[model samples]
Target: DGSGFLAIFIIGMFVGNQNTRKVSYILPVGEGITWLAQISLFLMLGLLVSPHNMVHYVVPGTIVAVVMTFLARPAAVLLCLLPMYFRRYSIKDLLFMSFVGLRGSVPIVLAMYPVMDDISNAQLYFNMAFVVVIFSLLVQGACILPVAKFFNVYAPASVAPISKANVGIMLNDDFDLFNYKIKRDSMEGRRLRTLQFPKETAVVAMFRDGHLMKPQGGTQLKKDDILSVIGVESDEIALNAIFSQDKPVKQYPLYAGDKIYDGHTPMTLLAETYNFELTSFEKTLTVAECMSYHLGGFPQPGDFMNLINARLVVVSLEGDYIAKVGLYLLSEIRLKEHRRKNARSGVSTLSKYGQKSLHR
Candidate 1:
């Protein structure tokens, strides 16, 4: 990457072929879209506000919002959405976005400024805004799920839809994310670990129905569970091939280990073999796969003293170990001493962590 600046000559269009690079396109796209949305908002708001009879139409205003949310929204939902229903903004999605027009942090303060100025009908404006917000949230938020079900727009596990990808890493390394829809009756009741996985592969994450799963060896992949797979460079093509194989497994997987992962990947191998616990707390743990180039090596322990005996464990940078290992070793020693001294008092907390690790 010494020549990182050299790669800028190619147009962005060619680079967006990959998800990680595609985001470079998306961020600007999103900003432009946001800017456009803001511009449209100002224009529309300026056109819609009729202060002359504002107070006189408070009731009608509320009624308009209700009608818009309940009638106009569902109408738009069934029309623009149903034709290409991959995961149609379910009733919940619409309900949340439609009615939950948030005033946000700034809006609350700004709405109050008019009151401080004591502008005529300022209180009414603020109060109306507050009331509309509350109604949108209360009435709309409450019915999100129900309306989703009613419209059959609610996300179902059976559909096994592919969702948008907003994951993976760029730790001075390449992270390619892939998504695939499992076919019906193809390979249900089967575990993915036993399958033919790609070389240099690392499946760091998996998602299902808006939930993040901590995947494991026995985590059987099911139909409709959107897989968020991350792999290094070598395996990218192989992963793409597997996802597009002649016949993808069809039967929906029944076993659910709760922990999510594609175990055939290098990530699972490293995690299961090394006893290294990857946590959300640690950001560097990201390079989704096990590439030979980035072993980056084992973690090393730094200087830390055990207060009980003031015992010391010094881990050197040598032996291909991570440099920050000693501090954790010391912490572990201290924790063990604390547990031994506290026994029953702190046993519950330590025991829980131990149990969870064992499950992993």
Candidate 2:
């Protein structure tokens, strides 16, 4: 009744909500403390367990363990995760999770309470709990890796830095410091100047084998060298590509306005950029001029002209002229409809433009 579990849980909730930035610092220390506490708990519980008494209950205890491991735990896991099946969780993943639900020191610790209270047959309860924990550790724990492999859920281990510390600088919400370790035969033997990092991102510092070094453009990167990079959140994908063993894929950042072309932009350039079909006559005109010709009147905001495989929607108006136009492929329209059906709130942006389509 006086267990500190609830109190500690409440404290953890408060700290997680209020001081998340400090949690990273607390984790390494908390992990060490947890290991020590688990060791002490098991040792104390072991002293109370009698081999002869436990042997008498082995058959029943094993039956309890078998029912819990194969039936109860799996049913509970399936029930809990059934609702999330649409979230890309396959049957194999759920099965693997069910099998690996290892019983640990908590049950034995709970069983000790009745013994301390001098309840009748409390020693039997403790013995049963110890057997369950031993069975779980020896059986489920040993099979975890094999089950993961059978489920095709095992992934190749990636090389990670020996140590990482968040700088916790509140500069810009979009920008932060990222740490990367140079992989062997990957980014190693390359100069910093040769790396094609995003223009907005830059190397701020370098650490080699636990020693701090100033990062310079001419400095050669070595295996296991840790680099502190300052970049926006979007730059992480490109950074990972650069540091990975595989050839980097070209990445382009598209802004919301990129889909909406300026009305003053040349029709020929837009046609070439998006591979839109344009007649020789239409290529000579600007986007606004072409749209106005097709409309046969003044173009206002929310006017759209259907193209071969895409639709051009007028985004905004400057006086009587089209100011901005959005291009949406037929596939994109269907995708947006699917998202709107699932999310129910994704149509706000398109709804602002009204329901006007111009067919030529």
Candidate 3:
């Protein structure tokens, strides 16, 4: 029986440590089964107990209770825990542990075994077990917290959990989950590929447009989307910056001869008008490779792509793909115009000074 119990415990530990992704999905069923079994066991034991017979063994039951609480439980804890260096239980902790060893109605069930076997003195033993359980439950169980506090072994209350996704398993302290609501204009229409997330961070799931979505690299995050982010403790700053709800700006079509924009003109036209060179590039790579201002791969609309001293905006998309990109040389044009204006002013000043000298 002991070997079989040990084998079952080992199997349980092995199964618990394996890939537990399915645990969240199957928790309701497992919890229901456990609750059902416990309820059935207690209900069966409740039917077998007789309250009138319990009073006969009160004196012997109290003696057994005192010995079990003060001697047996503490001795078991010291013998089992003190020898193991890894589980160094302090005196105060052991005191609290011993105080909380309340043998509830479980002993009552065990005492029934002798009665069922037609053993002599079974009635007396059962009554004693019942009285001991009542004393333990009414006294030790009630004073557990006070005993912990008196020993200074009570732990502080932990921070409340933010996620509603509850499975019965405890998570490792190394990992944590963060919840963020992508506010309007913040992360709106931005693809996951464009964002440079940290190595240890991952967007496990997202809620968008009233639907749950398992996001991938190419997935575009919309405004008001609730993201379920998982990351290590050290990556909190990076995660907050990525999910920040900054105000949105109007994205215009940055192209040549575009009538919609009043002040901002096309890059090529601006360059021609201002007499500056407009550099360009043609290449194709995965969206994952592309960044905020690069042209080696397909980029999202309104994203700036840079080249040799020129810039381009991804003006359009071809059904989840980049179709056309608008080129610009605005900075170069402004620089050239400023230099020309300075030269013209210098020349005008020289001409005026020469005319004045002639008059003098």
Candidate 4:
């Protein structure tokens, strides 16, 4: 089935959806799985290539790889992204995504025959494939984010699960939360406001023994609180710094009656409440985003479709205070359930956090 292009188109839609301003964080498990699948394919194909055979075709294969990564991939991305109406994806994000286009397992498996069977100049074919793969990995992997910024698809800052040993608790088909177990006795009793992290991260919620912690500043801490946080891919470094510190996290001063809730404000302002960005901002919408939100992907509290009791109480007739509270509250509930189900099987609620709009 030439459905390969169709599948790619669909995947692009999903990836583009996650790049939107309100929802852009990818599922940690899915992201990791993609890498795993790619690697597995590569390994399977590696058995097919012999060094002598690969060396000959190396140069031509590199040319093909470069063309695929630089030209074909970017063109596909532009086709998929242009309709979404994004303004942020700069030349950089396009360039980087294009660069990282590794021809992993599928190509390897397909290449096996050329290496095994005497196709004219077998070594040349093998070598070129190797060269292409290297170019994809080295040039592209090295610059994923920088390119994201250029493409204007770089995600917002917030707490994120460690990519290496990440644990995502799927609350249901719609929502999920990524978990990182903070070592016990570290940062015990510290207010949520005290954690030191970069602007590129957010601590969405916390948990203990699988029970969700209130997404509140006053929420006290205990050993082994399983923190459920949301952040862009970049915030991982800062997240590591905060959790690794472990001691009573230094507290930031809160003025009298200071509330973290800011109404329909710039993402930068709203994001200050958590350790990361409130949502990854994309100026445009793609077909996948429309399908995911089911209401044409408007970025308002009203857009938060099913937050139940959630309300977007506008502080100044502008902010979706209701949606904000709803997200925070949902985050709390999800955190608790994740804790209860930590060692057991449970659905993940992280994906459900923002689908509800609080226009009411």
Ranking by lDDT: 2, 3, 4, 1
Q: Give TM per candidate.
A: 0.30, 0.55, 0.47, 0.40
Q: Where does model 2 exceed 4 Å of error?
A: 1-14, 17-19, 26-29, 171-183, 190-201, 209-219, 230-360
**Predicted structure 2: clash tally:** 0
Whole-model lDDT values for every prediction: 0.46, 0.68, 0.56, 0.49
Model 2 residue 15 CA deviation in Å: 3.4
Best by TM-score: 2
| Clash count per candidate | 23, 0, 1, 79
What is the TM-score of candidate 4?
A: 0.40
lDDT assessment of candidate 3: 0.56
Give a tens-digit lDDT track for model 2, residues 135-250.
88888788888888999998656544344455577422435577988875756556565577776776777877686765433345778888888876567777766677545333
Error of 4 at 299 (Å): 40
Which candidate ranks first by lDDT, i.e. highest?
Answer: 2
Q: Please give the distance, in angstroms, between residue 266's alpha carbon in candidate 4 and its true position after superposition.
A: 53
Model 4 segments more than 4 A misplaced: 1-40, 53-68, 85-96, 99-102, 113-123, 149-157, 161-360
